[model samples]
Target: MIQRPLYINKLLGFKDKQLIKIVTGIRRCGKSTLFEMYQEELLKKGVFKQQIQSINLEDPLYRDLINWEKLYDYINAHLVDDKMNYVFIDEIQNVADFQKAADGLFIKKNVDLYLTGSNSNIQSGQWATLLSGRYVQIHVFPLSFKEYSSALSSDNKFEKFKQYLENSSFPYVLNLNNDKKQIYDYLGGIYSTVVLKDVIANKKIRDINRLESVIKFMTDNIGNISSIKKISDTMVSEGLKILPVTIENYINALCDSYILYKANRYDVKGKRLLKTLDKYYLVDIGLRYYLLGNTKTDKGRILENIIYLELLRRGYNVYVGKNGDKEIDFIAESIDGTEYYQVAETVRDPLTLKRELSSLDLVRDHNPKFLLTQDFEPNTSHNGIKQINIIDWLLE
Candidate 1:
């Protein structure tokens, strides 16, 4: 497995803490493998194997332990006294009333609990009410560009990046050796499982065709500002009778499944979040290519999608900035304060560079600003804003 130090460090940081650590992401995004890697680290640190109880609820061996009482009793029965027991449960949502089991385990001073789920619902509803502030969530995404590059033997980053976008970023794809057919097949299985099991069945939607249509439409338009009415109208014109309300629910389901992420608009001048014209980005660009194929190759938007996910991975609450009539591609806000970003395919043309920088110029603040592009050039500063090569920025 390719070591994901970013997430592993996070897990280590919270080791032995009182709170429950919940790792969530789209299915097949390496949540299971992450647990294995972290377990190895624990053993290296001299944590006894006997004190660790790792259970994958998806396995048939645990089929009989689906109820909260039985699951809690089974784990509690195996706990070693006078030692810190590290407990990991993969896909905890599979167990009925799993939050009660988690609450029970949390009360035991000797147990340190960790969980993995494929859906966002694990963090909400009854789980939130029961655990309250007693748990911390660590969301896992597919491999980033830096992680992807580290797995390849090639030194040419530009070519590897192109292959990364086309082939897929899910960790297992690296083992396929750049075969397009096999990669597509692997991505297809992931897509089907995520859609059929996580989305359709979990959301209890009867219209698989309409759900897929919404997915295809959203996947095709990743970086564009979109609304429910706009999607409903487009699909209607395309011969699908999807209502705005139903479309809204479908979009919400997709976001809940981690297949799509919604970035709400932030009014930079007004200093408030707006309710309309939100932008959606996919969890993996490879899934975009798998669903829509190579025909809709809008390089600029694709680059924006890549940057959006990177900002998210870097621990930023990303938003689309609305500065009066001008638009900033991203307003990445974190504990370190807000940063502005604008993405383009290339800014070699003087007119194009000026047009891209104009939006950042409108924001009269001292916060850090950046212009990211595909142009291979030495890093330069535009007044206070910085211009960087996207690939170099990703590696950094």
Candidate 2:
């Protein structure tokens, strides 16, 4: 089994803390697997099996325990006499008024609560109001480049990276053995489920066609600036009458489901955030390829998408930086410092390299600036900007 230390270590650090550990991410992104690893970790630490209560609400056996009161009663029944219990509830969103049950369980001195879900609703709005500051969300992303590379046939970094980009960071695809049709079919199901069950059904969106149109446009235009007005205009030009407000709601549903992430624009010169334009990157690259069916055209934007997720993994609050006339692909701000990045497929060509670095040159900050590309060259750094090979960066 692949030991995903990044997530495992996080769960270990927060074990038995007062705040509930909530794992949120795209469907099948290994949230449940993380729970399994944590359970094993507990056993290895000499915790008795009886003290761990794992409830998968989606299972037919637990179908009757859909209400918060019943689910709480079921968990309470599993509690062993006078032992510290670790309660793991997978797909907690399956339970109606799940927050009530979680709040009840959280107050138990003997219980440590852990929950996983494929939707962001657990982290926002009505749920947010109920939980307040009592929860810590550990976002579970698909496998990282390093995790993906560890399963490769050989230790060739380039080959592993090429495969990572092609096969994607999704965990299940690692077992598909590069079967294009099978991979597409698997990801297509995940996409449809997120759209149909999570977004459309949950949001009660009537216009499925318009929602899909918005998705297609957003998927095709990854890393590009997007606005409701612009999306509505583009769809209308294509003979689809999707209103700007409707587009906003659809994007919210997609983003709330963890299928897409929106990065708002920040005006660096003004030191203020711009709410008008934003860019949405998918939770996984494979999903984009599966839904859009063409990865040939926008290689740079796809690279940007990968970098966007990577920055997120590295614990940075990423945003699109607009500096006067130029734009930085990502302005990642962490507690320690801020870093600006420009992503490109290759900066080998002189003109292309110039264009890629031009934005970084505009930034006045002394913090590190980077230009990430796939092609490797000895003279990678120029004019205070460091050009790192994308694969090497991913591995690092």
Candidate 3:
């Protein structure tokens, strides 16, 4: 196992907290593996195997325990009272009224609860409304470049990183051989499962054609600003009659599925989110490449997408930095409201470097501002703004 320390660190903090450990992510993005990793940690810390009630809800053996009452009975019968009982439920969203079971379990002080789900529609009633502030949601993503490299052979690290950019960050794809067809098939399966779990199961979206069209349109216009109206218009132009409201619902479903992320354009000078346009970034680039059948077009924008996800993984509130009229690729702020970053693919041209650096200078705040690019230059202070390579910045 690659041992994702970044996530494990968060899990360690989740130990014995009164709040439920809710891990959410796209399907097949290693939620089950993360559960296993956390389980091992608990055992290493002297937790008895008998006290840990680990259940894979998707397994057919648990078919009889589909409802909350049956699940409660099943878990209650297996409860060991000698120590703090740890409950691990994978894909808990599959069970109806799971919140009742979860909230009911938390009433017992000796139980530590951890639940995993592939979607946000996690039984909306009492568990969420009643246990509002009592739960911590941990969002997990596909493998980062760092994690992907760790799983590959040493000799092919760089080549594998490039392959990762082309294929995806999904862990299973990395374990398999780097065959293009195999990667596409694997990612396709992931996409299918996410659509089924988050879209079909949670949201009763019957128009598969319209939803798939919206996905294609969004993927094709990765870095471009788009709206539901624009998507609806484009579909009509292509001889498809879909309502703007339907398009909005489909896009919302995709967002809930964690397949596409929307970057609402923020006006840094005005300090507000713009209403008209927003950019969409696919959860993984490999899926984009698999759909497009090319990884070379608009490489800069693709690199920008990579930077966006990395900033998110690094616990930053990222936005497209708008400096008056100029557009800075990113304006990343840490969770504590400290630190900021500006990412760009290259500053090869003098004008490009000057333009990129100028955006950072526009922000009068004396916080950490950096311009990340592909150029092999060390930190160059341009009018008090630091310029660094994207690779070095990411590794940092």
Give lDDT per model, in order: 0.91, 0.86, 0.79
lDDT (Cα, tens digit) per residue for candidate 1, span 214-245: 99999999999998889999998999999899
TM-score of each model, in listed order: 0.98, 0.95, 0.94
Count of backbone collisions in candidate 3 = 1
Clashes of each: 0, 0, 1
Tens digit of lDDT per residue, candidate 2, span 361-396? 988879999999888775367888998888889888
Count clashing residue pairs in model 1. 0
Top-scoring candidate (TM-score): 1
TM-score of the candidate numbered 3? 0.94
lDDT of 2 at 308: 95
Top candidate, metric lDDT: 1
